[model samples]
Target chain A: MALRDEVQVGSKDPSGFGVHRKRFVYFALIGLFVVQSGLTYTTSTEVPDSAATLSEQARHGEALYREFNCTACHQFYGLGGYMGPDLTNVISAEGKGPAYAKVFILYGTGRMPAMGVSEEQADALVAFLGAVSATGTYPVRNMDLTVWGTYREMHTDEK
Target chain B: MKSEWTAAKGFVVAGLIALLSGALFGVIGSWQHVIPGVVDAIPFVKSRPLHVSLVIAWIFLTAVGGVYHYLPKIVGAPLHSTRLAWLHLAIFIGTGIAVVVSYFMGRFGGREYWEFPPVLGIPIVASWLLLIYNFFRTANKHKGPWPAYLWMWGTGIVFFLITYTEANLYLFPHFTGNMVRELTVQWKAYGALTGSWNLLVYGTAMVVMERSTGNTAIARSKTAFLLFGLGFTNLLFGWAHHIYPVPSALWIRVLAYGVSMTEWIILARMIRQWRGTLEEGKRGQGSMTGRFLFASEAWVFINLGLALLISIPAINLFTHGTHITVAHAMGSTIGINTTILFASVFFISSAPITKNLRVGFWLFNGSLLVFWLCLVGAGMVKGYYTVLSDLPFQSIMLRARPFIVGFAVSGVGLFIGLWMLTWAGVRTLLRTPGDPAELDIHSAFLVEGPGSPAPENGHAVRQGSTTTLQP
Candidate 1:
């Protein structure tokens, strides 16, 4: 059987129309991707020192988080489910602290099912949340929007 | 049937089984939301991964199976090592079983999406190596300038290994120490991982189109290569869109947002060619491959529209953690990928039209449309309540409950439709395949060569004479 088509139909030029121009466009797009990836590695910040230091209890709580699939409902920093509020700073928020979190974890709340977590698990979860709370806040409630669709964390004296 | 191709058929059958099982678990998981303890035997945590991993396995297994089946024909050579292909299949199936067992035992040590025990990653990676080696070895034999599909397959195969390895980077203390870096890396790997499989699946779509239409020029066309390049660029840098809310680098979000919008070019191109495609769809309606190809086109339009909208930061703020995200996922995986795979499956099997199949197809698509809309509705409600109101989580869920119930109920219809189709597919796979030469020519009415008249008889010509069918 013949490999190439018999009639040699369509455009004959190997690179299609404007071959050299297409090559330039392809390279340009690739260059943009490389630069963007580099920026992610360089500009992104890491976890703070306090939050990075995970206590044994927090470690267990972290495991428990995955084991229970808390992400199925709860989120940290607005990245998990909409079924629960962002818990990034739940432990540190005014009028809500470790005790508030522990009670919810140990027993079922209105919408959130009681994970049936034991008292020990609840303490560890609180410790985990306490550590996470030290990292950052969620919803970035104070948004000073820039033209670029990014926000600058507006200064507030409320804290 | 070629003995060498038997394992490829087996892989596809395994994928269908996985699809059915995963979807069953999905139904259970969704209903758990409607009635809190519906499946007390398998809690949401366990059910979620079972659904996620198995469906994911379906995509990989089927996509890879399509490659194995088609590679030899396209490359004009038998696979370099059939033994390695078999080993790859064996290892993947064994690993899949292991993953299910771990999920059953409630042994989850990894992150979301891949909630299996971390150790399972090792075997999974090893099996992938066999595939990578086998694919490259086989594909290298093609004796011409490579087409866009080959490039897509090569990139997808190599990158999946890279991304899969990167996904496990959390084992390193340096990565594990910083939560921000950890999450960024995780999403990065996941984004690339998804892109990799998409490349494989899209390449399969191209090949199936090329073969069905007998239009080799389409694969080699300038437009095809440009689309492949655009998709590759997005696969590389567009992943950060998923992590925009993670408080990562501002540049990551900015770059991803820009990268993602480029797909509008593809959508626009599709729009330009819509009339031609509709004409082609009508011509090919008799062929199962034709119907599926048309279905996949519709899905691409719908899913791409949703994806483009959500990639915008302002909209993502509402949709990010909601069922809208799930909608996007389901749209891509089920709506687009699954349809394309089905086309490939029926093409390989030469599945004929039956009343049952026609009914299944309509039912599957109809149920999916409702299922998809319900998810979007749920997400919109949840997003509004969570972001704007001070409503509690349960209250928001209560508002979304009707849509969630609708989604779950439609899911049953989808499963039943899938079951009938899968049963037909499995029967096709188990039966011996006929000579490709005879089978390929008979389907010529489904597509035409570039500028060539539809042959009165089914056979197409090459070198100005009737020739053996290659695809």
Candidate 2:
């Protein structure tokens, strides 16, 4: 791939302005990097006590599980939706933790379509579910359910 | 002109298909709001997919047709095979229609944008492979220094293929672990596709400008090259904002911002330099099409400003994933790509098409201006209300109904303009007598000159007679 050749290359006139501009951009980028890095580090380090016990892979998986709104249909403990099977003790039922969880997610059941969950998300979800199953604790409440109920109440009262 | 009937037929047929699909969706989308709760009905879901998919298909087909028409001229070679072009066109159009149908039939993967399930994706992939074979074979057969525009397009095609493969993740079914990473990949693929399309558009513009103006300076070529490089780098790394909440390394964010800014700078430079080299006689006087073309330069700046605004960490935190980003997308795509395409079409169809299309041109530019204003203004209000003031998104959307209506109204103008363009293209194909003198010298010079026409009275003169008054 002549990717480099695609650039409009010109002979640099030995001028300090171009060099100065480059330096300026580099410095600005570095400064932004340091600030963002600090922020990320602080955010990641301040995990809750329950989450602190979870492995990094498990934590990552939990994050995905939350992001994808997987709990919208499937019940995790008494939390989440009632549309799908309760996954509270799925790890115990399935025998293997990550491997079985990965399969279920990749090739979903009859009603549930494949969610295009990547392997990384699958593994992380497995780790998170395994951690949950092993510990028997639902770390976070499903906020969407409460939000929906609150919206319903507001509408009902208005009517 | 090498009258490649097969390629021409492919282009015309694809365009006709696109027009039909766009009109159909346009009507559906217009009525979607009229039926109140009916818009959210299950049937509407099928229609929504059809609308979005058709838009994508039409844009892609038009872009590909433009590429086929422009590439050979830029590289100084006949097309590898008109037959292959037809085959590629057939596969693309056929698969596109099938996918849209399947989407309505509920045989979709249900992913936004990548909704066409594996069955549909396979044929599209095959079509791309066929295109790649044809393009590369043609490139290999030519024995000369390839133009920077062609180089940019070639690189874009290669990356497009790679990005598509990665996005499909068919090889690694278990590759879902990192949510941030996967989202990044999706955004990267989107950016790559859009960026490559941008490069191709700009590259075509460069070729057309060069041919019309009769100037081929190494400086101009270098500028084109720089723009393409910057665009590529920007696309590869500029998707960091999409993963703002994800645990990404700091360098990725830095790279994203840096590369994105570089792209803006390079494009800005190209526009400036091009304008600096515009001469008088080369482009005759009073060219509204040229004026509109020049006005589009302002949009580049507008896009640059928006890019800078969103690049800031504080603003990005609030604006990320909001309608403001949508505004930016519309601004760039509609503002930049559509404007440039209009200019090129006008230039190409000038002599063989309608005479005195000045009214159409102005109307088109006016409608676009209104369209963009409504979208951007409404987007800002929605963003501020929802993100900063803690207003409900739906409430803000309700408040912005007028603007949305304005957008729809503007779409009418766009529709009219597109019709005019289709008419002009047909007339050109038919070799009808258009006012050759109707071509403005200023626009001609800008095309023939080393650079684009200088900003005259804060407006650029437009080239060509058949200016569609569409936004």
Top model number, lDDT: 1
lDDT of 2 at A18: 52
Question: lDDT tens string, model 1, B1-471?
Answer: 365578788789899999999989988888877877777888776788899999999999999999888888777778888788889989999999999999888788888788888899988999899988899998877765566788889889988988888888877765665667767888888999999999999999988776776556566656677788888888988888787667565667777888899999988877776767677667768777778878888899899999988887777777777899989999999999998999888887777888988988988899999999999999999878766776766788889999999999999999988988888888877774632332453364444543443222111112222222443
Report the C-alpha displacement of residue B471, candidate 1, in angstroms: 7.0
Residues B1-471 of candidate 2: C-alpha lDDT, one tens digit per residue: 244433643554465456546545654554443333344433333454565566556556655666676555444466778677888888887887788677656565534455566567788778888777877876764434455556656766666676676566522323233333433444555666676667666665555444444344321333444455456556555756544323334455555656555655744554565544243312433343454456456676677677667765455544544445655765776577666655555554453323445555556567767766776666666546644453443466677678777766876786676566555655654562321222233343444333443332112223211111110
Q: How many collisions per candidate? A: 0, 38
Give candidate 2's error at residue A93 in angstroms.
Answer: 30
Error of 1 at B367 (Å): 0.8
Off by more than 4 A, model 1 = A1-13, A17-43, A46-57, A81-85, A107-121, A140-159, B433-471
RMSD of each: 4.3, 11.5
Which structure among the candidates has the greatest DockQ?
1
Local distance difference test, per candidate?
0.77, 0.52
In model 1 chain B, the worst 10-residue window by lDDT is: B456-465
lDDT (C-alpha) at residue B338 in model 1: 92
